[model samples]
Target: MNSLLKVENLQMHYFTSKGAVRAIDDLSFELMRGETIGLVGESGCGKTSLGTSILRMPTPPGRYVSGKILVDGVDVIPLPEKEVRRNIRWQKISMVFQGAMNCLTPVYTIGRQMMETLNEHSDLSRSDAESLIAEYLGLVGLSPEIVQRYPHELSGGMKQRAVIATALFLKPEIIILDEPTTALDVIVQAQIINLLKKLKQQFSLSFIFITHDLALEAEISDRICVMYAGKIVELGSNAQIYGTQSPKHPYTERLLAATPRLFKKVEQLQFIPGTPPDLIAPPKGCRFSPRCNKAFDRCFQEEPPLIEIEPGHMSACWLHHRG
Candidate 1:
């Protein structure tokens, strides 16, 4: 499969009064065309930062210090701002942000918002833009008439659908879905997940689905990347990630244990011992070593590089690499 998006040695750092915070460190991954890749991690694990950096969105006090982001083989890291705006953004890559419900304009009707998106990126007149809006809304299983309603009048699920519809309006090749169902109820989340599955097939789109929900990611992703602190601790296929076998990384195992499964009954779920280390002044060795029960002397003295354990399974723990 050809890679539609390739991120290599990506790093994002934040300058603060305390010190330099390493938000994302040496993260690398590839998303094949028409594949769904899930980025799973706990809060403050740089999942959202990774997504935003790919799109080159505003990151105040933060900068992309190093690395390469190649979309369709074009290195986006050092591309001129004008070229990125004119050639890369929106037309090729788009984002369905985390809080998409609040992204809608309260004053404007859904139709107007959709039309604005179409007009800005596409060469469509007022009437043609309105027609395109109807087509996109229909694509996302929403009625064309709903376009006339304002954001305040629509339900939470409806607002999210509208936001997704707007994202698909440009027919982007790669879409970053950053916790699209985070604010919705269970029923609504299911609906949104189903809708995403449907759209993925219809559009043949490659996605970077960022979320803390492990079960949900297992359901939709082709591959999973487990991140901890500011680095990728594990990367594997969905089966490798969710199979009966325990994950190699202790952090990954704890995350899987914490998730609530449908059939299994977990009386007392195991919790990770300590909080994630501060990026401003991160500990010397492995960032997860302090909380990890499997930590040893080497774990405290040296950071482990991500190494391939099996054919496609990669882990960055000394235990896995040494054994």
Candidate 2:
């Protein structure tokens, strides 16, 4: 499969009053054409930062610092701000942000927002743009009448559908969905997930789906990348990630144990002890070693590099490296 997007050693650091915070540290991954890769991690683990970095959105105190982001073999990192804006940003890549309900302006009608996005990216006239907006709304299983309503008038699920419609209005090749269903009801969430799967197949769109929900990722993701602190600790197919082979990385195993199984009712559920390390002043070696039950002297002193353990499975842990 051809890679639609390739991110190499991507780093996004924030210079705070305390010190330099490594929000995203040496992250690298590839999105194959029409493949869904789930990025799962606790909040503040650089999932959102990674998505924004790809789109080159305003980072404020955050800086790209280093690394290369290639879209269809084109090095997007070196491109000027204007060129990235005019050529690449929305024309080729788009994002459906978390809290899509709050993302839209309450005062503006759904149709107007979609039109603004369409007109900004393409040379379509008002009528042509309106037609396209209606088409996209319908594509997401939304009624065309919903377009005329203000965001405040729509339900949470409907607002999300409209937001998705806006993101897909340009028909970009890659769409980054950052916890798109987090705020919806369970039934609504399932509906949105189904819509996304349908859209991916219909348009052959590649996606980087960011969420903390492991079970949800297992259902929708082709491959899963488990993140800890500011790095990808494990990358593998869904089966490799979810199967009971005892994950090589202690953190990955803990994450799997934390996932709630529908058929099982246990008195106590396992939880990963201790919170993620502060990025402002991260630990010298493994950020997860403090909480990792399998931590050793080597894990606490040496930062492991991501290495392939199997054909498509990669893990960054001293245990895996030692074996």
Candidate 3:
């Protein structure tokens, strides 16, 4: 499979009066063409930050500290801001932000906003851009006539579809969907998920699906990347992450235990105790050692590297590294 995106030792931090917040610390992953990699973690675990870093659009005070973001074999981290916006952002990769309801401007019609994106990125004529917008809107299961309506006139599901349609208008190879099904009814969420699968098959596109819901991730992802405290703790196939095989990372185990299972009878849903560590000054050795029940002296004294515990499965934990 062709490699579409490669993130290597990518460190993105936010500078403040107090100290630097290590939002993404030495994170590395490869995204193959026409593949879906699900990023699952609790909030503030750097799922969204990783997405923004790939697009080189980290919010103010948030800046790239080190490492490379290679999209299609070309490193984008060192590119100029203007060059990144013109050649990389939206052209190669685009993002569907967390809240679809809040993504659109109430004053602007859907067509107008989408048209602006086309105008900024490409040299498509007005008629051509409008036609493309309509085509994409229909592609996402929204009616062409819906493009004329304002955001305030659309339902939550409609708005979400519209946002997705806009992301497709750029003809990007990869899309980072940050909680795409969020804040919608169960039926609507299913509809959106179906639409995404259809689109992925029809276009041969790759996706980075970011969400806190593990079940939803299992439905769409070919592989799963589990993140904690601004780093990946485990990465493996969906079956390896959710199947009978025990997870290599303690965090991964606790996360699966916390999620309710439909097929299996549940006496109680277990939860991970304590909050995530502070990014500004996280623990010295293993960031999860403080909360991990299986922690030992080695876990608190030395950070573990992400190493393959089994074929095509990697985990960063002392448990996997112990002699």
The residue-level lDDT of candidate 1 at 305 comes to 90
How do the residues 194-220 of candidate 1 rate in per-residue lDDT, one tens digit apiece? 999999999998889999999889879
lDDT of 3 by residue, 197-242 (tens): 9999998889999999998999999999999999999999998998
Task: Estimate candidate 1's alpha-carbon lDDT, on a 0 to 1 scale.
Answer: 0.88
Error of 1 at 257 (Å): 0.6
User: How accurate locally is residue 246 in candidate 2, as Cα lDDT from 0 to 100?
Assistant: 58
Highest TM-score against the true fold, candidate: 3
Q: Give me the displacement of residue 17 in model 2, in angstroms.
A: 2.0
Report the C-alpha displacement of residue 39, candidate 2, in angstroms.
Answer: 0.5
Q: Where does candidate 2 clash, by residue pair?
A: none
**Each model's TM-score?**
0.97, 0.97, 0.98
Q: Per-residue CA lDDT of candidate 2, range 1-323, in tens?
A: 98889999988898888888899999999999989999999998989888898998737788888999999899898889889867888778999988867978878888888887877778998888887887888898889887789988888988888888888877789899999999889999999999999999999988899999998998899999989888999999988988776566788788878988889988899998789999988888888999988888998898988999999999999887564
Please give the clash total of every predicted structure, in order.
0, 0, 0
Model 2: weakest 10-residue lDDT segment is 243-252
